[model samples]
Target: MSKDINYLIKSSIEIYFKNSQIRDISFNTFLPENRNLKSKRSKLKMEKEGKNNLRFFIESKDITAFRASINEIITFGKIFENVLNLVE
Candidate 1:
C-alpha cells in the first residue's frame, strides 16, 4: 500500500526539503523510511477537496528518516515519526 501513498511523503519531502538537491527519493528507494517500506499503492487519507476529490489512489510505503549528524546533512531520525504526522 505504498506505491502511490508515497506521493504524500514525496511531496512533503520535496516541499519541505525544497532547498536541498536530493533527487533520489522515490517509492522504490527513498530516505530512511525505506527501512521497511515494502507494501502497495494507496491514497486513503488525502484531503482532496471539491472536484479534486474524485476518488483518487496514492502510492503507499513505510516512512524513512536518517541520522545525518554532519551539520548541513543533519540528523532528524528521532523526530521522523513526528515529521510523518505533519505530512500525513
Candidate 2:
C-alpha cells in the first residue's frame, strides 16, 4: 500500500451507537452518501453485552439544518483547520 493509504488507515475513527436513530426517512438519500472526505460515518456494529442493557432512545427533538450553505461548510472546515487544535 502507498504511504498515504497507510496514514489514512491510521487516522480513521470508529463510531458505535447502541442503537441508531438515523432512520431512512430522516436521510437525504439522493443528495449523496459518503460525500464528506473529512471523516466518514463508520458502519455500526451492535452487540448484546448483557440481557439487561440500557437502551438509547431518540427523544422528540428536531435537527437543525446545516445552517450554512455547502460553500460555507467547506469554508468553515478550512477555517477550523487553520485555527483549531485537534488532538489525536
TM-score of each: 0.20, 0.20
Query: lDDT by residue for model 2 over 1-88, one digit each (tens)?
Result: 3323222111111223233332221122212322442323122111222332311111111112121223333453354345434421
The total of clashing pairs for model 1 equals 24
The parts of candidate 1 lying over 4 Å away from their true place are 1-13, 21-30, 41-88
TM-score of 1: 0.20
lDDT of 2 at 66: 21
Tell me which residue pairs clash in candidate 2.
none
Each prediction's RMSD over C-alphas, in Å, is 14.0, 15.8
Q: Count the backbone clashes (under 3 Å) in each candidate.
A: 24, 0
User: What lDDT score goes with residue 27 in model 2?
Assistant: 24
How does candidate 2 fare on TM-score? Answer: 0.20
Query: What lDDT does each candidate get?
Result: 0.29, 0.26
The CA lDDT at 28 in model 1 is 18
